[model samples]
Target: MSVNNKTVWLTGASSGIGLALARQLANQGARLILTSRREQQLEELRQSLPNSEQHQVLALDLNQPEKAKETASAALKNTPVDILINNAGVSQRSPAMETDLTVYRTLMEVDYFSVVALNQVVLADMVKRRNGHIVTVSSVAGKVGTKLRSGYSGAKFAVIGYMDCLRAEMAEHNVRCTTVLPGFVHTQIAHNALTGDGSLRGKEDQDNASGISPEQCAADIIRAIESNKAEVISGKGMSKVAPLLQRFFPGLLRKMLANR
Candidate 1:
């Protein structure tokens, strides 16, 4: 599961944890394929990495699942993706009651279906090679549901289940699947989250503003991968506490979340 010297394909490479991961992975000597909608930003990221010439930028819009899969599958023809980190996703900031149905679908498209699409595209090669690792960046919201996040939670929860099932079937093929639940990291996720009417939230949440840095989150994830962990929760304080409460004291957790 070590990323060192492996070929890693990462999505959401333009910013946040994905960007942090790109730097760390490249520093670890992994050849990289950086994917995101921001081609210019991805190019800048590539230039900033160590041994910059070793990495590549493949601009992809996860919103377009079929095109993304096709593009990634074509890249597979030239190079193998030893580690596929499905990190490109959007969040939601509207209540389930207020959320538009289309908003939910949009969340599913970017946060769940897109992950599935990319995984399927790369997994065929992994199974054939009998080697590979899939690291999906899910969220703490998926673990402990709260107000104004039904769509986001649903999509994140869906991906966790999908990766788990994928892990089960891929076990025989020796491919690994690791689901990472990261709490409110200081990223643009909140700012870019969808509102009830399908517009951007355009504001950072208080929790996000005070959360762990993306670099810290990325470092923890890299450690999880190297250790071959099945699941890892990356964060501090409430991020580390809520899930425990959810599993051991659901009623209390529900009451607490209702007030948030």
Candidate 2:
């Protein structure tokens, strides 16, 4: 579906891919309900748009899955969510064994549970209307596991599966579900990812540092949404060959990673 003049609710809108998408959507005449934990950043982004005053920003933490329904309800009060972009997520930098339980749980809450919760809350309305689009932002890691990203990959895979199932179920209802699997977009996700504890990882992966920009990622995502594509893989490293190598040529992939 075309994005123009649609009421779209985008989470993680304070920065990175979400922020870039908000800008692009605003320019294209869409009304957006921007959400994130940083109200200041949201406000700044709100002003960056064309008719800056027209956009809306709601500050809410996605870690609290229970709050998703309430947040959706509030957003729908002004404008019903015709399009829901589940772009809010976090990552991890350590292996499952080394990462604290709290860290993993937090990642699960944001990357998986909250997205599911929000989708559940908004879906009934969309189904009743028999029209809507839901875009879920997954990672390339969702398709293939990697070292130091065990928890992150697990959560991404779970969300991807959930979205896939939801898409299958919603096919008859005119609601489209598209899962965007990006390899590495030059976003601040690494900066916000959890370390061993609750602290931010505060470091960008070398590959991510050299990855695609959030603007480019947003553009590709918009194209996918327009075409109602079920799945999309962005970035060079997200190729089908990457997963193939992970399965059959694990040793070679490991050596390549070691060299990186």
Q: Which candidate number would show the highest lDDT if scored against the true structure?
A: 1
Clashes of 1: 0
lDDT of 1 at 166: 90
Candidate lDDT values, in order: 0.91, 0.86
Residue 59: error of model 2 in Å? Answer: 1.5
lDDT of 2 by residue, 1-260 (tens): 89998888899888899989998999898888888888898898888888777678878788898886687677666466889999988888876677888888888999999898888878988999999999999988898777788888989999989998999999999999999988778888888778776688888877788888899899999999999999998777544367668788888987876664
After superposing candidate 2 on the true structure, give the runs of residues whose Cα lies further than 4 Å from its correct spot. Answer: 237-241, 244-260
**What C-alpha root-mean-square deviation, in Å, does candidate 2 show against the real structure?**
2.2
User: Which tens-of-lDDT digit does each residue in 1-260 have in candidate 1?
Assistant: 67889999999988899999998999999999999999999998899899899899999889888888998788778788899999888988887889999999988988998899999888888999999999999999878888899988999889889988998999999999999999889999999999999999999989999999999999999998999889999999988789999999999999988886
Model 1 CA lDDT for position 1: 63
